[model samples]
Target chain A: MSAPLIELVDIEKHFGPVIALNGVSVSVKEGECHCLLGDNGAGKSTFIKTMSGVHKPTRGTIRVQGAEVTFNSPRDAMEAGIATVYQDLAMIPLMSVTRNFWMGREPEKRFGPFKMFDFHTANKVTLSEMAKMGIHLRSPDQAVGTLSGGERQTVAIARAVYFGAKVLILDEPTSALGVRQTSNVLATIDKVRKKGIGVVFITHNVRHAMAVGDRFTVLNRGKTLGTAARGEIKAEELQDMMAGGQELAALEGSLGGTI
Target chain B: MAEANQAAAPIKDERVREMSPLRKALIRPELGAICGTIVVFLFFLAIARDSGMFAPEGIINWGTVAAQFAIIAVGACLLMIAGEFDLSVGSMIGFSGIVIALMTVQWGFPAWFGILVAFALALAIGALNGFLVIRTGLPSFIVTLAFLYILRGLTIFISITTTRKTIIGGVREASEGDPIAWLFGGKVFNGLFVWLADLGIVDTFVAGPKAGQPVVEGIPMLMIWALALIVFGHLLLTRTKFGNWIFASGGDAQAARYVGVPVNRVKISMFMFSAFCATVFATCQVMEFGSAAADRGLLKEFEAIISVVIGGALLTGGYGSVIGAALGALIFGVVQQGLFFAGVESSLFRVFLGVILLLAVILNTYIRRMITGER
Candidate 1:
């Protein structure tokens, strides 16, 4: 319905003799959920890493809002409004929630040569932001390690959102979560989409992808196998394609007699 | 149906329910340190009473030692809290004292001017240490260790060249009626310098000792200096944004950098603070002893670090308090002097100190676990 916020064209990456990504391309429209589905060794990791400025593509162009650009570091990506939430969350567990929220960007009260952290303002703002994400944290002073995995993910997402992320790239947000927790994360994705921010949801679970994804791109052996709209494909068909379709079916048939 | 019935059943385990408030309080993070402090204090009191160590003179002597250690330890704590170390503090003190002595006694410079020059030199040295550590990205331990030797060697070379003597001898008193000398060494002259004297406020608050004896007044100027530093350090650590960045950098430097904190700047400033503290302590020592030696503050780095660890600071950085470190230095001072009054052998005091160090490590680890709620 609207122009894409980010579009990768003919992206290719190579490491020595190994080809990590081969002509992988995807487009994320504004306010849309674009799911990248791939199994192990399918080049999803490489594509995301390239997008987040962890690696440079050997060939292809990355256009942000219709303008081609090159990123030298994660800071460059952040400056371009592309925020990535890595699986590890990039949070120090021992620190208080408020400290983690405003770790590098703390509000200061200056007095001559002395500068003090404005804890009162930081704590109030952090709590309010978390509340906006439907997270009712008991205290902003609680150590992040004391929170659950789901809650920690929420905090990271909320932090990214609060810091003015235009495009949020989630690396397997629900991969480690339980059933109910996975549902919670899906709800979070919906909330992000509603905010008119493009979301690139990276996951291998076909059913989970089908749940929140409006458009899907499937990768097989470092290349895109297929791209389909939600209404055009069923979950079973997506699963079949993900499992290599005819080749897997033939193998299953060949092994059916032996089993 | 059987699986559903099993899942529906409520577990009645007492341990899985809830812990009592008393149990929770017992597991508080600060409890271990608080208990250790009290136990150590009582142990010293008991031993001191048995050895006639509770005398007023003994108290005064220990107070002086504690003040010395506490002042430097406060600065060391700040550095460690920011996740760095300064091994050159001992040498910095030696160098600062040497500078003051050479300026005042040899060059015929006024005492006030000598102190000012010495402080400026110290600041330069501090800035150098900070710059090197931040730029190189090497561990502070190696950098400061190298600086310690370099500073010590420089002090020796300067002392030998200036006085044609290896020791440089003691400080010479200023002539009476010399305004500069009075500013540097005088008691009370209604001047800004006197008002800024280390223990001026404490002396006013606490009445002077009995008429004849030199009144061991309220607090030593050195003690007041240490206390003021403690208060300043506390404000820096808790009340400031830079303080938060320091903790974050120490706790997880990568995360701190990811969040846009200037990690290098914070670390460099921390090193400078550590060196500045050493310089201040050196000035106080020169004034108190009325002399300077090439080895004035030898091994003080170890004492400061030990005091910081005992005060509940983690060597890994990110969690500590200046007040805690000052208390730790006080503990060390009390133990050293109290052992003498308790009739303990001087050599055996080392063994007692070793025990205290081990206990402190254990207590620190225990407190960390409590804070993290680890079983």
Candidate 2:
């Protein structure tokens, strides 16, 4: 219906003669959940890194909103409204909820030689934002480490959204979560999509992909096996593709049932 | 239906047991410090009573001494909270004091001008220390240690080269009653120096020549300075964004950077603040003594660090309180001075201090684990 928000054309990455991403192409539209699925050594990490500006694709062009761009640093990506919530969450758990929410960007009031942080404003903003995400925190002064895993992920996602992230890249947001926690994270993703932000959900879970993903791209052996729309592919077909069906079939033939 | 509901609820109840109040309190790391402070206070009170040392005058004297250490310890706490150490604070004090004395005695500068120049010099040295540490990526401990020697050597070299007689030789000598001398060296009433004495609060204890009369007139201006610093330091560490950044930077520098915090700048500024506080203390010492020597504040850095650690600051940084550090300094000063009043050998104070330091480290480690929920 609209031009892709981010398009990776012929992307290639190599690490000292070992190709990590070889001629991979993908496009993510605005307000859509694009799932990148692959087994180990399938270049999923490399592709995400390239998209997040941690690495420059050896030979490819990245276009955002139909404009070609090249990123040399993660900061560059951030400047372009691309924010990544890493697996570690980049949060200080011992810090207060409000402080963690406004870690790098804190509000301040100045009085001549004396300047003070505006904790009042920080608390109000963090609480209201968390409320918008359907999280009712007991106290803004509570340490972040005391929060559940799902709640922490929500905090990170909320921080990115509040800071005007147009494209949110989540790296294994549900990997360490429980079943209910994973569902909660998926709900947050759905909420992000409703707000018209492009989301790149990177995961190895097929059920999770089927839950909120609109498009799926399977990567294998540092290359793309196929890309399909939600309605065009079945969950079992995607799983078989991820496992390299032809290779598995050949191995099964060689092993044949004994007796 | 009733049996099935009870069976399901029992399983859920067993999975999420509520924590007891005692369990919660025991798990808090700061609770240990609170208990330790109470125990230490009771011990001092007991010793004071046993030695007939509970008089108001005795309390005032001990408090005055404690105030001095408390003030510098506040600055040291800030430095430690920011994940840096300033071993040169002691030397910076000596350097600032000497600078002020030389300016007044040798350069014919007014007392006010001397104080300002000394402070500026101290701030510069502090900035330099920060710059060197940040630029070279060296540990602050080593950088400050080198600075300690450099500043100490400079103070000695300057003091040797400038003589009092040589300074006044080339200028028209003013009388002893000149306003500058009066301002710098004047006494309040008949016995106490004006700046070094507290009049309003201490006046109540002053007795008019009766048996067991209070001997001391008032608290020192140095003590007042220490109190003010403690308040300001508390505000800086707890209520400000800079304070939060300091915590974040010390907790995890890489994480702080990823979030776009200027970690290096926060650290360098902390070093500068430590030096600035040292200079302030040095100026007050010089004014109180009416003279400055190359060794005026020797080994004070160790006392400040010890005070901070004892007050509940973690060496690894991330968490600390300026007020806690001031209290820690108070504990040190009281024990040292109280030992004298109790007829204990002065050298024994060192042994007591060492034991206190060891206990503080053990307590800090335990509390840290508790706070982090680590086994």
Candidate 3:
């Protein structure tokens, strides 16, 4: 429909003599969930890391809002309205929820010549934001480590959205979560998409990806097999594509059992 | 619509566990130190109260000793919370004192000039320590341990070569009338103490050359420095964004970096601060003693860290409290002097130190487990 919010064209990444990613292209439009499905060691991590500016692609053209850009650092990517919620969630567990919420970008109030962090504003903002994510924290002063995996993910996602991320890249957000947490994360994705933000959902779970994903792109061995719209690809077909039907059968036969 | 409804109607979520206020308070980093201070105070009151340990002069005695520990404890507390250690702090104190003595007494520089030079040199070495740790990715314990020996050796060598002795005197005369030296070595509120003595509010000398003079002169600059540093450290760690960065860097440095925190800068600045505190302690010591000894601050670094640990800082970092560290120092000063007041063997003070440190560590472990929900 409209021009994609962000586009990565012909991305290639090499580590020394090893090619981690080769000629993989993906794009996300406004208010759309683009799922990148891959098995373990399918180059999903390297691809997302490159897209998020942790590593520069050896060859690629990245476009944000139809303008060519190069992100030299994670900060640079953030400046371009691209935020990545990594798998580990990038949270300081021992810190208070409010402190972790406002870690790098703390709000400050000035008194005469001195500036101090605005704890009142920070606490209130954190409460409201966590509430919006359906996480009613008992206190903003509670340590983040005490939160569940699902709640921590919600905090990270809410932080990315609040910071004006136009294209949010989530790396395996539900991989370590329980089934209920997985559904909660999917619901969060649906909510974020409704707010007109582009989402890049990377996961190995085909069913989880298919739950909220509008468009699907399968990555196999550093190359994309194809891209398909929601109804065009069934869950079974996407699952088979991710694991590869022939390879599965071969492994099953070699093992003399179902896997 | 669901999100809007959820935000509009703030229901107490069933999943969100609420902690009792008592449990919450118990998890505070200062809890152990606070409880320990109260217990220690009560114990001493029972045994040493009639012995004049609670009297003005005795209070000042232990207070001064506590101030010594508190000054460096504040620095060590902040640095440890930032996920680093400065084992060289003790040696830095000795090194800084030697530098000041050499510059002022031997090299013919002014006291104020020498003080500034000592601070600059110490801070530079501190920066180098931070740089090496960051660049080599070495554990700070090893790096600073190396510096501890390097600095101690350098101080001794410099002293012996220059003056043919390890101790240098005449600093008091050289620093006489120097405004900066007075800030470190001199007393404050002298008129107030004298007025208190005249009003019979304080004990005064009843005979001899010092008759009518109050036994406790005034609040020494050392006590003031300790108090000021404690306040400054407490506020900085609790009420500032840099404080957040310090916690984040210590908590999970990689996570902090992912969020764009300047972890390296926060750490380096903390190292420099540790050096600054050591230099302050050194300057005050040199002025008070009217001399500088190459081995003056021997084992002071361990004392500072012990106070911080007793204050409930994790050895791995990410959590601590300055007030707690101050209280820990207070306990140290009191027990060290209380032993004498109670007529116990002075060497038993070491036994007390060892026992208290073990107890604090055990308490801290339990508190950490409670907070982290770990077994």
Q: Which candidate has the highest DockQ of all?
A: 3
| lDDT (tens digit, per residue) of candidate 2 on B1-375 | 443333223332233346677866665434434555666667778776766455545776787667767767887888888888999999998888888777776877876777778878887888898899889989989999999999998888887877732112211132134443343233323344222234432333244554232255545666767888899888977888888899898877876876778888998888888887897777666665666778867899989988888877877777777866887787787788878887878998899878777886688677765454334
Better of 2 and 3 by DockQ: 3
Clashing pairs in 2: none
- Provide the lowest-lDDT 10-residue window in model 1 chain B: B210-219
Q: Over the stretch B44-136, how does candidate 1's per-residue lDDT look in tens digits?
A: 876567554554345667877888898899889989988899999999999998888888788877777887888788877877887888789
Q: Each predicted complex: what DockQ? A: 0.31, 0.29, 0.59
Q: Please give, for residues A199-226, the per-residue lDDT of candidate 1 as tens digits.
A: 9999888878989999999888888877
lDDT of 3 by residue, B18-112 (tens): 67777776778787888788878898999888999998889999999999999999999999999999999999999999999999999999999
TM-score of chain A of each: 0.92, 0.92, 0.95
- Candidate 1 has what TM-score? 0.81
* Model 3 vs. true fold: TM: 0.96
Q: Which parts of model 3 have CA positions greater than 4 angstroms off?
A: A250-259, B1-10, B15-23
Evaluated on chain A only, model 2 obtains a TM-score of 0.92
Report the CAPRI category for model 2. acceptable
**TM-score: model 3, chain A:** 0.95
Steric collisions counted per model? 7, 0, 0
